[model samples]
Target chain A: MFFNLKDFIAEQSEGETDWEIDLSPLLALMVTLIPVLLLQTSFATLKMIETTLPVLSDAEQKPEEKKKDEIDFNLSLFANKKSELVMELVVDNKRLKSVTIKPDGEKFDFIKLQEELFAVKKKYPKENRLKLMPGDGVPYDIIVKLIDSSRVTPEKKPMRFVSSTGENLETTFLFPDVVFGNITN
Target chain B: MSIVHDIVKKAQKDSGFTLQLTAMVDMFTIMIVFLLKSYDTSTLEVKNVDGLVLPSSITAAAPEEAMLMLVSKKGVFLNDKRLASIVDNKIEAKSLAKEDEDFIEPLFKELNIEAEKIEAIAKRNSTVKFKGTIFMQADKGLDYSVLRKVMYTATMAGYGDLRLAALDGEK
Candidate 1:
């Protein structure tokens, strides 16, 4: 067989034209990014709650005569040091009852707090606003848990409410509107 | 006769080994899909700082782009810049009460600058509106007083809409 260098070069060039690009670098990049993205995936699940600072205004104060017939269902919760949770029910700017919840072992008794709040929810089905006034020393996690407890009834103990269609439905909406307030002792 | 038999046996053996990559490729494919699915691009970018573990919540709304303030046990930060140290879950009482008169000076200054910048941008661009919002990320262990001070400073700086950042609880 006669070896033709020109023809061999031409054939090699033609074969090169059909060659596939190496995707190994791209694959390596993807492999490297997967773990980084996985670590960052938690930020995607980040959530937020809209809160406003409690404003003090003279307009909020009204004469006692005007509010005689109006029943305010707003509940106030105070978490103090020594793991004590004080709950107060305010009706027409009057304190109805103040209940203090102590810790169960090493943790605050959230179940008891939920039960108390649930009772209030049952009494005032239309009232949804709650004021959580955490003491200066109370940790933020406890406040978040308190908010969680006040906002909804736990799944384990789902409350039953009659729907507009007259069908009884299990719901978790206890007090969705929460106003963060200063601890006024 | 023995040598000829050995040669025939050698000739009958398979030639080479082949590696199957189908299973590996499938694994990588699934991994890529899972990673992509878990990556959330809609939420605001948050970097984990030391001593700042976000509390978990069941809410699902994404945060808007706004001034970022981080309150941790170690210190208070505005957009990653340390403004003040937290002692006993409170910013230096002197600075808040007398020096700044119930306002965190550094945080207030930073937030005021940001609010003014946003206001300027809104003035030039008719479509842009200053929402006066701040995205606050505080450590789960921080006291409410610290959060209150930070939030109050932010509100005074004209960022009234406070969006508290938290981790999404497992549903």
Candidate 2:
């Protein structure tokens, strides 16, 4: 009976007319909004994810420390028929030290060169890396042996080949400068 | 009146708003997804300087963004501007000397300016962080000593990251 009264009785105030509430349009509106809301929400979520990617932090160092780190000490080994081996430590274009390794017939004395190299290592206590540039005509096996000799101490760095094409060819950061030359047919 | 009420109810029930937008929303979603996926995160690929013959290398690598420093049979160029004559198995020091200032120092100053500008732009936009790889497109017949000095000069001018340009896939 109370439900009937509420349904039947129409209250009139300030010239208002009785009307039934229609939910169909509201339902349609909500249905339309679902996909838009989903899209916007997904876009916002993806944008947030992209922004949250971690950036690598650079190692902090003082100017003096950086300068010390940038001191490029390179040892260039030039082999000729006369001397057999000419080892020169080129510190920024100027030769800081040099040594001549004479071939003792069939045997090469690498241990003596290693001892001398160790002495030079103590000189530049900071960033004691020595980039090695071996000239052409040096045997492959000899180059490998020199590499082993250069690695006598953990402090002693490997060599890098200085090719005309500026490329870091080595997979590992050692043996700095090795020019790749073509074999003549 | 009952017929009119039925028509009104049907009209309200079938507003067509949701129906119209369903397909549009799907299309937009797919477009957005593809746009996000296909976007290249890397900066502009630097092209090697044209007309300059680069020394061939089996071990040379492809550089990222690079600044073109063309070394031709005629002269040394920093992106079209002639810097010096490379001849006689050596970089003629006389060729590098200007009115009073030295050639290498002036060249250094110019290169530094370019590098600083690039660095500044990179600072604001990280997508272009690699300022300029010094692309030494030196010719094959060029003197080795000249090439060596060019390498040294470019490296000393705050453009140490060197790149020798070459024909792709050619040894």
Candidate 3:
């Protein structure tokens, strides 16, 4: 037999070398699918900022209970009509500290507000609730920005705190509990 | 001159090579798979209103299932039902309750009726209880005065837990 390995291999491989794969259906499918997916795709995700509102109570009125040694910080923020943001820190039903953030050039200073909140958080690491009182003339967007500034740090890192159960916990939550106030007379 | 002419002629000729679609198809498949996987229906979609622009927030709280309330510049709606009409950036005088100017009569009545229905259902089903949670999508342009009125009315109607809906975006 006068057989050459190169010729035999070449002859065997040549059968499939010229065959073309059909890509028209796949191209058409991708073209059709991309538009539909693009139309269905929601670019922005939705989130929620949970807040507790004051409710009517039917329980008998009782005097508030205060511990002798413990000084719990009850933080409250008020945005007045003049765009003046006032942060009042009350401890055991007594006004402890008041920090005011002034507006600069027709815009409320949100960065200054966040810095103050960060400072307060550093001093009182366990305090969790913030009473947001958006007074008249403050826009809804600014209120939302204030809430964001009060809740999160610029770096968006978790802060550590000791829980009521004495367990050490790390959380991204800063003043996560928001109580809406300043609505009643 | 001959060499230049030859090069020009060679450049003009078609190579006849088919486009390499395998890699493109592979990329498309990956993209399609990712898009399909991310198609979540658990979170409620905030509808696109004519004059409503939701504020942006960095809050990581995922939106839960609750009664949806939309407070746009045009009106306040409850689950796509128009309850109050706002004109000139304020709620119309006719819609406000006589007893309390801050109270929206229509919204309060509707919320009360819904509360009744929910309470009735909750009686038989011990697992489900009326927690009074409302997911509110309010416009960014509206004033805090308007929001105060709505929130007051909601509290009166027994829906005290308010969850403000917002677009999740960068600071």
In terms of DockQ, the best-performing candidate is 3
Each prediction's DockQ against the real complex: 0.27, 0.06, 0.36
lDDT for residue B90 in candidate 3, whole number 0-100: 83
Candidate 1 per-residue lDDT, tens place, A1-185, comes to 89999988998888865444333444455667677888767534677878765433346676666455446566989888667899999876887879999988868898999889887776667678888888777888888888888887875367886654466656687787877766222
Candidate 2 regions exceeding 4 Å error are A1-75, A79-185, B1-53, B92-94, B97-106, B123-127, B130-132, B166-171
Cα lDDT of candidate 2 equals 0.48
Q: Which of the predicted structures, 1 or 3, would earn the higher TM-score when compared with the native? A: 3
Model 1 residue B45 CA deviation (Å) reads 3.4
Ranking, DockQ, top scorer first: 3, 1, 2
lDDT of 3 by residue, A136-184 (tens): 8788888888888788876578767565556776756567777876766
lDDT of each: 0.74, 0.48, 0.81
Minimum summed lDDT over a 10-residue window in model 3 chain A is located at A16-25
Docking class of 3: acceptable
Docking class of 2: incorrect
Q: List clashing residue pairs in candidate 3.
A: none
**What lDDT is reached at residue B47 by model 3?**
87
What's the lDDT for candidate 3? Answer: 0.81
Q: Tell me each candidate's TM-score.
A: 0.75, 0.38, 0.81
